[model samples]
Target: MSSSQQSKLIRVVQIIIDVIFGGLVFASGFLILWIIFTPLILKTSDISITASIPVAIGANDHPQLPVEVVGATGKGIRAAFVSDAQGTLQLETTTWSYIIISNIAKLLTALMLAYIFYLLRTVLRSIRAGSPFAPENAVRIRRLGYLVLLVSFLRPTVEYFAANEILNQLTITSPSILLPSPFKVEMILISLLILIVAQVWSYGLELERDQELTI
Candidate 1:
């Protein structure tokens, strides 16, 4: 094949790879938001929990709780809200709130991952062309890598607290001011997986950028 033809083929391949990678990242963000909102949607049923039921009728027993909502939007929006509830945990409380926050973080993280993947594909094309330094792209990729790392570091703190608090309450293993830990672990695991994927994509971009810069 002619050199020009070969370079064109390589660029086409890069574009294909980028499309697939970008799709995955986009789906990741959507999935994270779904995870966050699942509880709220399911909890549409009024959730009642007796912190302490009185044996006698007319016993002044009430369960007051603070609940928050967490989640992401299709267009890179993150949202959260709080409600004061009586006798039942609001849909806003429990893992839903944390899910919203986690998904929001995940949405941003997903964008970083997608951008990194794009950078990698570009660098691959540059490599094939024997024109090493794609300096502007490299710089941007590096910045995105750093941002991904920062987001990853923040995720554990955000994911774990909600999961741990709810799990401990449900399991009755700890007096944490949370409840109904049933789905906490699942939610957290999903978030962790997303974080890992985002970080890997980010680092991969960073490496590609470094290689291009060096060449």
Candidate 2:
């Protein structure tokens, strides 16, 4: 393709990506707000916890707990246990109020990702304008790389604590422990690569400035 055609194509693709990121940011922000204010908007009594925990059982024994019951303490207890010859157990819960704070951290990570995309879109704009090695573009790229690194470090810590908090609130006996190496190796590598590229771009910008001065 011709240079102009390539630039146009890149611009179109960047625009599409920008729109998608914008939509994601808006959706995440809306969810965060909804989660935060829903309890306040509705009556406390109206808010209820509905959980589903899957239990594996031996074929020889009947489940000790009934599917649904009201305890003597006046609280509703709902449980389901299925017999699995393979002996596998899975537990799932949908307690929005209890997990809202965790969701906020996750949503904030999404917002940070959206911001990275926004920075990338700005760099694309500079590239389309035939100034790919502009000093500002290099700075923007560095910022993007830093944000990615920050999220990589923060996300796992937040999630680990959140999972523990959820388990604690649900009165679960099992412990939720996250590994020490929570950040993905691939993400760390990618962030390092981006930072390297940003440095290279900065060097190219310096050369361009020197050339302009020499001319």
Candidate 3:
């Protein structure tokens, strides 16, 4: 595409980033207020917190509903269903502490995301100004990479602790599964890829300087 078209596309993307950044800021603020004061503000027993958790169903947990069977060929083998094991967990409590515990991770993630997008918007602004290889952008990109890595680990860690707190306050139930893992391989890979891109950006900035020097 021509430079003009590319500029327009970049501006459009920047606008989208701005929208997302605004939303994140708003959400983070809302969560903080709700966590700190909402319970005191709205005193009622109707409040319920809902979240999802990894779970496992026992081998015999399948529904007993009969279904049409084909001609029996091989012997039926016992099996069970496993997934990125997940189930919904809901708790009704008027206690403010539990509510805060349930939502703290979401708040942390949202604020981190807003910061990421803020860096992204600055990078895009530089690109839009025709200095796509600005040196500071390399630092910004590296910061973004590290921040994402932190988020990848931070999110699950916080969630695990928060959920564990709730679990500690309750009784155990059947069909148990492990809690969510602290490490998500895919997110780890993405952070590494971003770090690599930051290195590439640094190289591009070096080349930009060399080209200007040569001129």
Best by TM-score: 3
TM-score of each: 0.40, 0.70, 0.82
**Residue pairs of candidate 3 with colliding backbone atoms:** none
Q: Show where candidate 3 strays beyond 4 Å.
A: 42-82
Evaluated against the true structure, the overall lDDT of model 3 is: 0.78
Q: For residues 27-121, what per-residue lDDT tens digits would candidate 1 score against the true structure? A: 77677767665676658856532122111111123123334465635565566544323222222344454445435544555665676577667
Off by over 4 Å in 2: 41-97, 173-181
lDDT of 3 by residue, 22-141 (tens): 999999999988887757754754655444333223233322223334543456734433344444466666666777888888899999999999999999999888888988999999
Model 3 sits at a Cα RMSD from the real structure of: 5.2
Rank all candidate structures by their lDDT, best first, as comma-separated numbers: 3, 2, 1
Off by over 4 Å in 1: 1-20, 32-40, 43-95, 98-105, 125-130, 174-215
Per-residue accuracy of model 2 over 42-148 as CA lDDT, tens digit each = 54545553322222222224222222333434256355333222221223334455546546656777888888888888889888888998889989999988988
